[model samples]
Target: MTGGPATDEATEPYRRRIAEIWSAALGTPVTDAGHHFFAGGGDSFQAALATATVRREWGLEITVQLLIDHPVLGDFSERVARCVDER
Candidate 1:
């Protein structure tokens, strides 16, 4: 997260917000956008909770499987942003 610039301006906010949500859900500071969720102590239950939080916060329907599909925080953030834009 620190070493590289965010993928773009559109995704940076999503990335930061997701990192905060995932950090709380995972009980660890998820500062690195490239870090894998599962590798950062995330599980299915936590993923569900995190996505639920995202839904509540953004009013977006992000499936938990999206996180499973894109485990990397950066990729996940990009997808989430796309989802938001799509809606």
Candidate 2:
């Protein structure tokens, strides 16, 4: 198994990308580490849009449920790391 610790280089870009998507979709500056997508007035439709945007931007397959399951930037970054490891 190649699964191990993810370095900052690998995680930082993902976090930034996620933050950009959230900020653009919500029209708010999400500069915090504890921002919640759904709790911040992000509906299912908006989440779906985010999923598509992430896929297009990162070329990674992510479902809306996955986005819902991991709302915060930190958790979503972990998920992206796991997906990269899996691939």
Candidate 3:
């Protein structure tokens, strides 16, 4: 996954996009990347929806385990971008 302060600038937009996804799926505003999806009332079913949405929107495959592991938006978005890059 992309790392360091340099990526922060690039990841800012990704953070916004991910926050939007979280807000839409969880039905709550998620302004911070540190926010936890599960803590915000997101379950595995919602995570599946999120995975599907990401797949459809970005054309990149994301596993549910990834979401489970990276519940934080910043970490999850970094993983998503890594998967996209690898593919």
Candidate 4:
């Protein structure tokens, strides 16, 4: 957390993967796993796309609200990982 780039560098692979999906779905550049989805000008439609992306990527059927609750890529990845673990 010292250097800004270092923080992003420390992002988990899953978070990085999800961040890529989010950027593609939202048509914006999202390089940080700690980014807030809605604050980045994302809407419900984009959230849906992101949710579907996650499903395709991890085979996890999660709601858009899950993304809403999780917002950041790292937290979202954690939530999805927990859901997968629960099953």
Candidate 5:
């Protein structure tokens, strides 16, 4: 939430992958990491689906509350990358 979006070379992969998952879950093409998931027609169910997909694909546990906290794709992806790195 501070500085610019939490995106960089390190978090790019997570941004892209999470975007793909979000696109599938929301049934919309998500091209910008700046796009907010909820603003882009996402709901609780879609968030759950995306979260599950992320967990299955990356073996990382991301909660819906986390998603809600970081609704922006870039921010969420950065958090995901951090979680992966921490593991």
Candidate 6:
């Protein structure tokens, strides 16, 4: 808890949102951080679509390669948060 509860709490919504996006893209309920999008029957095309959706939904600029590089929702969210913070 060194990061503080407030910081942790702030990340929760982002995590949940990313999870929802992942679930929607995969067309299944996914609640685990270990879930791999591509391994779970998602293709590059799907990843591209998902990236576009995330960009539009989150208002963050992201590329399909970024989604492919970070397939897990948690990782993607962390990356996106970093990108947002940098901007």
- Model 6 C-alpha lDDT per residue in residues 1-87, reported as the tens digit of each score: 244666556566777877777778778887876678888878877787778877897788789989788887667767776777777
User: By TM-score, who's the top model here?
Assistant: 5
Worst 10 residues of 5 by lDDT: 1-10
Q: For residue 10, what is the lDDT in candidate 4?
A: 48
TM-score, candidate number 2: 0.81
What RMSD, rounded to one decimal, does every model reach?
3.7, 3.0, 1.6, 4.6, 2.3, 2.7
Candidate 2: tens digits of C-alpha lDDT, residues 1-87: 232454655777777878888888888877664788888888988889888898787677779999889998777776876786676
Tens digits of per-residue lDDT for model 3 on 1-87? 447887777677767888888889998899987888898899998898887887887788677888899999988877777677688
Pairs that collide in candidate 6 are none
How much is 87 displaced in model 3, in angstroms? 2.7
Considering only N, C-alpha and C atoms within 3 Å, which residue pairs clash in candidate 4? none
Name the weakest run of 10 consecutive residues (lDDT summed) in model 2. Answer: 1-10
Q: What's the TM for model 6?
A: 0.80
Q: lDDT tens string, model 1, 1-87? A: 333454477789999999999999999999887889998889999999999998898899778989999999988988888888899
Residue-level error in angstroms, candidate 6, position 49: 1.7
Candidate number with the higher lDDT (1 or 6): 1
What C-alpha lDDT, on a 0 to 100 scale, does residue 26 get in candidate 1? 97
Candidate 3 lands at a TM-score of 0.87
Q: Give the TM-scores of the predictions, in the order they appear.
A: 0.89, 0.81, 0.87, 0.79, 0.90, 0.80
Instruction: Please identify model 2 stretches exceeding 4 Å from their true place.
Output: 1-9
Ranking by TM-score: 5, 1, 3, 2, 6, 4
lDDT preference between candidates 3 and 4, better one: 3
